[model samples]
Target: MKMKVVCVGHRMPDWVDAGVDEFVRRMPRDLPLQIVEVKAEPRTQGKPVDALLDAERQRIEAAIPARARIVALDERGDDLSTVALAARLRRWRAEGDDVVLLIGGPDGLSPTLKSRAHELIRLSSLTLPHALARLLLAEALYRAFTVESNHPYHRE
Candidate 1:
């Protein structure tokens, strides 16, 4: 069974595009991967940051599939090792669950969206730029799949 990765984020730089393209190209053909990016709202003068985050959250929620397992990329989320992520991916595949990885905008995901996620994953303890986070996540997903299939791409 193929699992889908839905990444929701705002405007991304050219570097992000390049990184995503490279990772997607290197991914195994057997694994069906889809990336969904939600446009983030522009912050206006005097406009609260929370409002912008809320808008992005709405967009993300609307795009997510009803049956998919939602996982939010958040700083306060659980930190898992690469091998553990691979194991989780394998289990999800066996259980026929499509994975949806959510990437929030600058201010991060809204409380509602975060609560709705089946799991919240923190990529690192240090805060990372949203654009960089997306690329890193794509690579991590690729690595997880490679590990699951015992591919040489993932060392240790």
Candidate 2:
């Protein structure tokens, strides 16, 4: 069965493309990957960061597919080890559902989106730049898929 990964993120600089490309190339050819880019509004010099974050939340929500299984990435979310993530991916695959992973803007995901997620995952307890977070998620997903297939890429 083909698994679909729909990742939502704000606009990023060119540097992020390299890492995103590298990890994406490592994913199995059979798994479909789609990137939904949401444009971030330009921040005024002295505007509170929260305002920007709220705008981001709206953008992220708008990009999500109506029927996809939502997975929000938040610092306060469940912290799962690699093995656990693999198991979750296997379960999702067996259920034959398309998974949509959300990456919020600088402030974070809105309460509504967080509450709507089928699963909320924390990539790291430590805060990371949105661009880097995207790369990490892509790589982790590739690794989890490998583990589920019992590929040598993931050695126990």
Candidate 3:
């Protein structure tokens, strides 16, 4: 199954792009990974936080493929080890539907979106910058892939 990271932001830094590209490039053709960038709603003084999040949510929803399994990344979600993530990846591959991993904008994802996800997971307990989170997600996914393949990229 193909995997897509539907991130609610554009114009990631050069370093992040390079890092994500490397991981994406390393993925096997049978289980390819793609990044779908959504324009982040412009935060303004007058616009409420909920409005911003809702706008981003709409964009994220539009990017998702029909029947895709949604996985929202949130601070409050389950903290998965690499092996656990590998198991989830293996399960997704078996299910044979595209998986959309959502990374919300600055203020985090809306409650509605998170509630609807098939699963919610966090890369770390500490809050990370969006760019760093993207990079980390890419690398983690790559490591998980390796673990599944017995490639020695991931270690205990």
Poorest stretch of ten by lDDT in candidate 3: 147-156
* Candidate 2 per-residue C-alpha lDDT over 1-156 given as tens digits, one digit per residue, 9 for 90 to 100: 344333445556787877777767777776756667776656689977777777777777776666778888888888998999999888877777678888876567767778888988999988898888887888888889888888888787
Descending-lDDT candidate ranking: 3, 1, 2
Q: Is candidate 1 or candidate 3 better by lDDT?
A: 3
> Of the candidates shown, which would achieve the greatest TM-score relative to the real structure?
3
- The digit string of per-residue lDDT tens for model 3 on 56-111 reads 99999999899999999999899999999999999999999999999999999988
**Model 1 TM-score, all chains together:** 0.90
lDDT: the better of candidates 2 and 3:
3
Candidate 3 accuracy as TM-score: 0.98
What TM-score would every model get versus the actual structure?
0.90, 0.84, 0.98
| Backbone clashes, candidate 2 | 0
How does candidate 2 fare on TM-score? 0.84
Query: Candidate 2 regions off by >4 Å?
Result: 1-15, 45-51
As for TM-score, the candidate ahead, 1 or 3, is: 3
Error (Å) of candidate 3 at residue 75 is 0.6
